[model samples]
Target: MSKFRKKGKKSQPAVNTAALPDIVFMLLFFFMVTTVMRETSLKVVNKIPSATEVAKLEKKSLVSYIYIGKPIAALEDAFGSAPRIQLNDAFASKEDILLFVENEKLDRSEQERNKITWSLKVDKNTKMGIVTDVKQELRKADALKLNYSSKATDNIAN
Candidate 1:
């Protein structure tokens, strides 16, 4: 009998990845819950013109966007080439501005309602008539805090 027994080759223990799937699923669920997807799809050709001075909104959450532009090539057949007002995801007339403003106001708390800013994203080629009408409608809604969306530019005569 050999005095010293040969050492047995012990296989290394396999890594315990039993919780791997659970961890992956937990991460997936977390992203799904926290991810904020686009709420509205623009149906118009929004080409915001450049401006000499442009100021960014302080609180984006308190701002509601109104898109004004001609219909895109795809939508031209149905909506025509005329400029349209987009409230949320749908085309809205000036008449709808009042309701839209009211709805926006209702979405925010009473304390922050007054701070809500209505941003107008007017296309460059769009005429001023529609914009003026929108402004008047906003006035009726009493949403006086208005902001015009424009790209910043360096050169300005003023």
Candidate 2:
């Protein structure tokens, strides 16, 4: 009787982790299929001024971009130098800008005009005089919605 009872089989966990790799692979595949792609490709390079509180803009808003500095010179002259603002460009002149804005606003119905939003995406190196002039021009146009950006990026905030 002692010899028969002398040894007993040791208990061990029967569950094996051999299937863990397959389970992980399946879960990864499921997530990969369900993931959604987001928009990309808007790259702005400029020093963004700091703000105390940031406000989010609604998805539905009209944004007009303005590059204050000069346009890039010819390819030969474009060796790591800041480009000048091309006044020939739209919004380059205060009058042209105001006219363009007024025209665009006129095209919209009164209801739309009431909700019209004007955003200024000026470059960081923009001259104070130019920015002030632009502001004055916008005011002359009676544009109520004004959003001026000091950053070089695509962020448009109040």
Candidate 3:
């Protein structure tokens, strides 16, 4: 009925930004609470194997540490000196590692032995051949559940 329709009006869509910040905060809190920290007595850098499928060991008592380095360096590091590997120190060679693991497997209570796990930490500059040789030594000792990890977060290889 008017000479012309009222000038059309456009509505600006409403955007809800309030919930976004809350959601972001919730996610951050969840991750912070759920994160795990690995505990270890000694520190060394190692390059561990990666597998899409793997199993975790339940018992900590059966675990043992293996250190590999140039024969001289390994010996020196095991004993009194800088960069000491004294997480239950007293190992100098493959023989010593094997002996210690064997003793641990035997000394543990029957219940503890059933859930044993072994872990190794070695220097990055160490040779693969030496690493393989050490693995073989561990195998001979009947240390079946072996695990390896880097000493420092920064040293973890891609």
Candidate 4:
């Protein structure tokens, strides 16, 4: 009967974290859907040549990139300033072209193999001789479909 009598059992308040995990998962999926990861780290500099007339490629999955450019500052001492071929992430000789094409073809489905296109990302300053050699090697490997990656040019006159 005193002022401080025995009190009834008190309910403890708790933080409701039931939806926290769901929210975290949703954010993770949103980032995954929006992000585009680079397939390979380019070892060479690629300042693509410009062109007036150009076609945009529709299916990126069917395209394989062949980078041709002068060695970047870091690689200048080892590879020199001359333009060179890069397959995947490393510097490659023209002799390795056929084998590279064959290996890339093996990664596609049988029906899609014939549709694979080689996209040449050549530097503007690169000599035509190296580009021509790459084309010849690609032909030897039966990779007939080709695309030259270039920037759009405002100048219409050649």
Candidate maximizing TM-score: 4
Task: For residues 1-158, write the lDDT of model 3, one tens digit per residue.
Answer: 34334433445568978899999999999999977555543334434445444456455556666655333434544543323232354435555667677677787887777456766666656657766867787678777777764433433247
Q: Which candidate is the best by lDDT?
A: 1
lDDT for model 1 comes to: 0.91
Off by over 4 Å in 4: 1-28, 156-158
Candidate RMSDs in order: 5.6, 9.0, 9.0, 6.4
Question: Each model's TM-score, in the order given?
Answer: 0.76, 0.51, 0.48, 0.79
Ranking by lDDT: 1, 4, 3, 2
Candidate 4 lDDT over residue span 1-158, tens digit each = 55335433444579899999999999999999988799888878899878889988998889999999999999899989988999998899999999999999999999999999899999888889999999999988999999899888889465
Question: Which segments of candidate 2 are over 4 A away from where they belong?
Answer: 1-52, 73-91, 150-158
lDDT of 1 by residue, 1-158 (tens): 34334334555689999999999999999999988798989998899887787887988789899999998899999989999999999999999999999999999999999999899999989999999999999998899988889889897544
Please estimate how well model 4 matches the true structure, expressed as its whole-model Cα lDDT. Answer: 0.91
Query: Per-residue lDDT tens digits of candidate 2, residues 14-100?
Result: 899999999999999999997856332222233335444445456343544434543334422443344322222322456676776
Q: In candidate 4, what residue range of length 10 has the lowest lDDT sum?
A: 2-11
Pairwise TM-score winner, candidates 1 and 2: 1
Off by more than 4 A, model 1: 1-36, 156-158
**lDDT against the true structure, each candidate:** 0.91, 0.55, 0.59, 0.91
